[model samples]
Target: MTKPIRKAVFPVAGLGTRFLPATKAMPKEMLTVVDRPVIQHVVDEAKAAGIEHFIFVTGRNKGVIEDHFDNQYELEHTLADRGKTKELEALLRDLPGAGQTSFTRQQAPLGLGHAVWCAREIVGDEPFALLLPDMLHLGARPCLADMRAAYDRHGGNLVAVYEVPQDQTHQYGIVGIEPERDGAYPITAMIEKPKAGTAPSNLAISGRYILQPRIFDLLAQQERGTGGEIQLTDAMIQLSREQAFFATRFDGQIHDCGSKIGFLMANVAYALAREELAGPFRAELEAMLAKG
Candidate 1:
């Protein structure tokens, strides 16, 4: 029987240097997209995908993230006392259960692989999902849920992939696939940021992953790649050679909230997609465009 992916590791230890002054005081994951923080959106997606344990690999000054997931007693009491049923219900809806959440500090800015390794004990020896809080995937079906369905059928390591422009292949980890089966391709090899014109395919690996525990072993000895940091893609490349690895092409739009323009676009897109905000937001946006 295939081991169920019940836990998810979120690597949010990055010092969001790109966002500068704002990120200096607060983590990029805590920045708001629409009304909810970016990390909350990722956790909600994982919950929708049936993830039971939420393990966050955070860094220094990231206490706000923990507090965000915890119950706000004072605020909840205030809302309840005022008879604001809807507000109270909304606040309580997304908070994870007491024991369902875990937080570990990465201690050093090593790399994604190192950050994931920080959650090794909590993740144990089971297949787990890894999600990057900086990437928000919006779709009719949750991105991780679709990846989980693929993982169930294939019974292997699955990486959520999406097509990127040929010129942009160098910006992501690219994969070479065998044949397309059920919207997924058996990943033959993984190339981390391939050089221009040398990429095998444009199927770029996104932030979502359903990785087996064996990967943890590989990451432990992985050598730094690219920017002198342990690259998870490098270890994954080794795992693909010895185990089953597939690339599931996700049907969604991924907004890279790590960058300024991308963060702005995420706010605009999510706002425009909301039922209550769409009409007004679009009108105001069009009015601004007309003025320009």
Candidate 2:
């Protein structure tokens, strides 16, 4: 039997200093995009891609995240008593069910590599996905689903790539590929945030990935690379030689939800997508735009 790609890791350990006072009392992932928190969208995407187990690598002051996924007895009772079944169902929905989700604390700000390594025990020896909760992506199909299709066919590492401006290559992991098949490339190497005019390719690694379990061993060394933190890209590069990696262009419009402006943009974009709120939201946005 084929091993199930049932587990996923969400790295939510960042302090979210970029969001300042708003995040001071709450986790950044809890920030709402329209009516749902940013992490909820990420969780929904994972569920769409056939993921059954949710593993969160969290840090301090992240209890709210845990509470959000758990059953709220008082809230459910109020909804049931008031005959608010529709709203209650909507609110209570989306959890992965009892015993299907778990959390592990990182306990330090080591970086993405360390964050992924923290979930090592839960992940075990199965191939799984890593989703960045801070990136809000919208597509006809979920971004994780896009990568999973490629992963099942190619059977190794897959990183979602998108075309970024030449000057912005220093902001992401750029892929160097040897075209292997349709819509997939055999990764020759990866340059993590290369200097301007030195990037291997403009196809930058966005926020989604399906990685092999072998990467856990490379991350075990835990040597600090670029940015003076244990970079996940570094470990990925080391594992690329032993197997193969692919860069698949994800069909989505990604908004960096970690930044202030990006957060506002995501809210506006998502609100416009809602039927009940779209009319008012767009009218307000148009008035704001007209005034500006």
Candidate 3:
């Protein structure tokens, strides 16, 4: 039987150098896409996927993130005094139940692998989900929820993949897969940022993952690869040698919010996804394009 994925590790320690001035004083994960913070969206996805524990690997200036998940007593009191039941309810709705969230400091700006490794004590000896807050998935169903379903069937390490343009494969961790079987592809190779034309397949690894606990051991021993910082893909590649790795091509539009263009696109995409906002937002967008 497959061990249920009860905990999720979120690596939010990145210094969002891409966003510059805005991120200078704020963690990029706290940036808003529509009204919700990017980290909140990722947490909601994990919550929807039946994940009971949220482990955030954080950095020095990420205190705001911890506060965001906690109750604001003054704010809640003001809302109550103002008779703003709806507003109060909205805030309460998003709050995680007591003791459901945990935070650990990464301490250094190492890399994705190091951030995830920091959460090892929290995750214990179980398979867990990993979601990159920057990669926002817009779909009928949450991306990680889909991955959890796939994990139930395959019972091994699974990474969410989506097809990218062949020439653009070098920008992502590309995966080579056997033919699709029951919506899961057996991943034969995972190369982090292969050369433009040397990629084995067009399927790029999206930022969602369902990984076994053994990956922590591999990441602990992992040496720096690609960049001077340790790369999670390097450790994953090593883990694949002994365990079965599969890829699930999720159904969604992924907006890479880590980049400026991707961030702007996510705001627009998420705004258009809301029923109350979509019609007016589309009309405004059309009008702006016409003026241009």
lDDT per residue, candidate 2, 1-292, as tens digits? 3355789999998999998898998999999998899999999999999999999999999999999999888989999999999989898777679998999999999999999999999999988999999988887788888788778777888888888888899988899888658668888879888989888889988889898898899999969976788999899988887877888886567889998898899988888778899998789989999999
Taken over the whole model, the C-alpha lDDT of each candidate is 0.92, 0.89, 0.93
Clashing pairs in 2: none
Off by over 4 Å in 2: none
Model 1 Cα RMSD, 1 decimal? 0.9
| Worst ten in a row by lDDT for model 3 | 222-231
Off by over 4 Å in 1: none
Query: Which pairs clash in the backbone of model 3?
Result: none
* Candidate that scores best on lDDT: 3
CA lDDT for candidate 2: 0.89
The residue-by-residue lDDT of candidate 1 on 101-162, one tens digit each, is 99999998889989988899999989999999999999889999988998888888999888
Evaluate model 1: give its lDDT: 0.92
Angstrom error at residue 235, model 2: 0.2
